[model samples]
Target: MTSTPPTRRREWLAPAGLIALSLVPVLSGAARLTQLSTGATITADNARFFDSPVPIVVHIVGSSVFLVLGALQFAPSLRRRRWHRIAGRVVAPAGLLAALSALWMTIFYEMPASVTGPGLSALRIVLATVMAGAIVAAFLAIRRGDVRTHSAWMTRAYAIGLGAGTQVLTFVPYTLAFGAPGPVLHTVLMAAGWGINLLVAEIVIRRRARAMSARRGRPAPASVVSAPLS
Candidate 1:
């Protein structure tokens, strides 16, 4: 029997990992949508979502498409084909939809203060806006034929969009160790989730830049990368 080459196998690892992480939020979003559609029991936590269903529906569906399809874009082999361009057409709009809907929810949703304190709401508004802006920047870059800039911006947007998945990771360990976090701790944990994703995205962007530069026998570009949104 033949086996896949290690180098070939390694190329798929990143996208696979991203898809795995994305599944957490995707599944949770699915459950939320199901609850909304089925008219599940209204609780303090979910009442806001039920009342304002449009934004949440848009956000969930859009993010699901963006995350799943966007992951495939990271696969080098897949990107080498026409599939990448076709997928990007859908992925870009989906990402914008997700980000903009999130911004709407953050601004308009009336959640219990205990669940979503002012600080957390403010953070969401800022991050959601940033995510939307990043997607726009990515689209503009690609239109100008600046592939590197487009990739970097898309990476930043994807990182911010996936913050909810990262939050599950952040909250799981803390919740397991201690009971449910209070407002301050909850805000800190949420920030940590976005912070971690952005830091990793920056590292990936710089590494890719260096690799591309090296391929052309040039020094790596200076790191004047723009800041992450979420």
Candidate 2:
């Protein structure tokens, strides 16, 4: 029986951490906070937008589609063929709709104006923009046949897209540690959650690079290369 290499071990760490972290909200019962009766929910007072039937329908459908496609990113075989292409077709449009709907929802929905202040709004817009950009970059990279770049960008994008889960995970520990009440605590936690996801993606990409380099053996230094006789 062969033991896994150190590089493979390192590569597994982030996804394993994310998978475990993703379960915290459900296990801790933190998701209940989002319910209407929880009295801890975030929403805008613009009932026309928050309570609008059309946006809600779009939000549900788009988010569901994005979640399914995002999960497929973790499956290497599924990401390698025509099926991946078909999935991409579905993912791109759905993801865009999800992001747009979410942005709109955030705008119309009121939280503690202190919590949803201009800075927080800006951060949400930035996250949404980055999410959209990542999807576009992933599609373009694949079209150019740069699979490594494609995978890296897509993973980052999907990670950001799945950030609602990360946010919930962050809130539980933060609330426990700080006794959550202040807007500052919530803002800090949300930012930290997105930061953690981005960091995880970066770590995964770097580990993959290291593993590939190890598999190929480090190339001889250019300074050591002898020129052909002129």
Question: Model-by-model lDDT, in order?
Answer: 0.88, 0.63
lDDT of 1 by residue, 168-223 (tens): 99999999999898889988999999999999999888888878877899876453
Error of 2 at 105 (Å): 2.9
Looking at candidate 2, the ten consecutive residues that score lowest on lDDT are: 221-230
Residue range 14-94, candidate 2, lDDT tens digits: 445555554543333233323423444345543343345466457556766676655664655556567987887897778
In order, how many clashes per candidate?
0, 4
Regions of model 1 farther than 4 Å from truth: 220-230
Q: All candidates' TM-scores?
A: 0.94, 0.69
116: Cα error in model 1, Å: 2.1
lDDT of 2 at 16: 56
For model 2, what is the error of residue 94's alpha carbon versus the real structure, in angstroms, after optimal superposition?
1.8
Error of 1 at 22 (Å): 0.8
